[model samples]
Target: MKKIALLALLLFLAAIGLFLAVVWNGYEWHQKLTVTMDTPNGPLSASSVQQMRLSDKRGPWNPPEGSGVSFTLSGEAVVMELAPGRYLFALLTGVPSLGRLLHPKMDVIDAAKLLERGEAEAYRSVTLSRRDYPLLVTFGDMNDPASVQRVDPANLEASFGPGYRLQSMTLALTEEPVNTGRVKKVLAWIGPHPELKLSPPTGRTSNIPFSRRVGEGDFIRGKT
Candidate 1:
């Protein structure tokens, strides 16, 4: 009886250790960002999404298996966890018809093709601020690939019909400001420009997370 009890205790400790390891790894892998979709008229279901693509200007890519950006579709909200970096988000969704949009015949569509075809449902430029830790990006939701429930690829054509459409996209910033020149260049390269402009920083202060450094700007004054 004593030996059985000892084994049970050891198993319990092992489980706890495993759980902690997972949590630590997740924290190190990527930061979580909350994204809320805003439609002019109303919110739509996540099921409308077909796939999502990300680009860092090197090449288009999908969420890597264990440690790349992934999405969670909860009702009208989609949360994405990604390693901190600048990224272009392409939202692919279904539309009733594609009169002018190019219909590519492939499983994974390249982001460039989406641009050339003018079929991208939504496009957004995101820069994850290291200072803000986990950044929050809220905008209109598009078709997300990482929803809790996914549609079978075999049934996508049947589900969306032959006229699935890709349209609408935008870009915005939160927590930190980015270089204006860089933003312009990126937007021009992406082709579909979102109706966004940099706004003056709000003069708000907070100390709960950490105090803002005073006289820090003096060090780099007149350098830029």
Candidate 2:
């Protein structure tokens, strides 16, 4: 009886080990990518970054908990050994020049205060898909048509305040893939939530005719 019991225990342990191995194999496919920058500031490190995982079938993955790739940045280079899945990467620096179009009145500093005041600021997002191995990504000053349009001296000065100029930095991947269905889902989600929309203060503006009259019927009614 003792011998039989011991053998049964061993079999149970072996079954568990095999199950774990299969699960790891199914979930652990990863590839390595190298990223660099041309500016003197050097490579981006862990200090200023945000990352998200992507699903080939569903789009971006929002795990209830944390589940993503790991990377290391050295000087102007970054090496990411991410699971063989899609991912989004963002590097943080100073204010993005073209971001002015989104919130003309808000500077990065002012945006930060809005956070402190329990408000929110929206940031611009761009996506690129990479399908090849040994991938390399480069970052430097932005000169793209969209960036150029937003940063034109006249536009920036008008929107971002007098004398303000727009200077932008950007990222580029060597092997960009066409927009995948998954990327569209991710973009749809990056927009500001409805709750974040702030209503303008209730008051008269210069544009309103001084002759206009206020009426109680114009106000929203409450349930009796």
Candidate 3:
């Protein structure tokens, strides 16, 4: 009877040890990642953007083992590189949620995408006015890619995803801004731009599981 009890106790201890090891590794492996991106405008100054962050470890939302994870693996931030003349928006990845906007094909996701996956059930996004961010927009000729004939924030737009709740932060723009000159050439791409107004909402716990398809930034065409 004593031998049987001792063996059982040993097995229980081993099981607990294994459990702890798994937990520790999970926490370590899921540590957040950070990255930067340059858009047609100046670095979408961090203070001028809205943000949302959340993650879920289990389930239909998570990538298959060895497939690479999303939110839990990286933190995303989107910054525009708009300039006075001749500016190009380079894709910025690893920003917690903004990454999803740059490349949906990538394994990662933004706050809204995670919400779609059911990871962020309480996720709430608000659409604000473009008057907030300091920037100017020129409806460039898609044919030239860099040809700017006029600058019109009215014809000018600073929108976000075509449908995502993602909000844009406010930045100062040049009034009566020029469009045909360098200002026009700079900040060219216009697939709906969003200024990332604030940090995305957060869940109380990481274990909050999720899965689904929630689109962000109808900003590109969402408003139209």
Which candidate leads the pack in TM-score? 2
- Give the candidates in order of lDDT, highest first: 3, 2, 1
lDDT of 1: 0.26
- The digit string of per-residue lDDT tens for model 1 on 178-205 reads 1123222322322222221122224666
For the record, the alpha-carbon RMSD of candidate 2 to the native fold, in angstroms, is 21.5
TM agreement with the true structure for every prediction: 0.17, 0.21, 0.21
Stretches of candidate 3 exceeding 4 Å from the true structure: 1-52, 57-69, 72-83, 88-90, 96-189, 192-224
lDDT of 2 by residue, 80-137 (tens): 2121231212211111222222345865334333322333233223222221111222
- Which ten residues in a row are the worst by lDDT in model 3? 210-219
State each model's CA lDDT, in order: 0.26, 0.26, 0.30
Error of 2 at 186 (Å): 28
Give the residue spans of candidate 2 off by over 4 A.
24-34, 40-224
Top lDDT hit: 3
The positional error of residue 125 in candidate 1, measured at the CA in angstroms, is 16
Colliding residue pairs in candidate 2: 29-84, 43-75, 43-76
Model 3: per-residue Cα lDDT at residue 197? 17
Candidates arranged by TM-score, highest first: 2, 3, 1
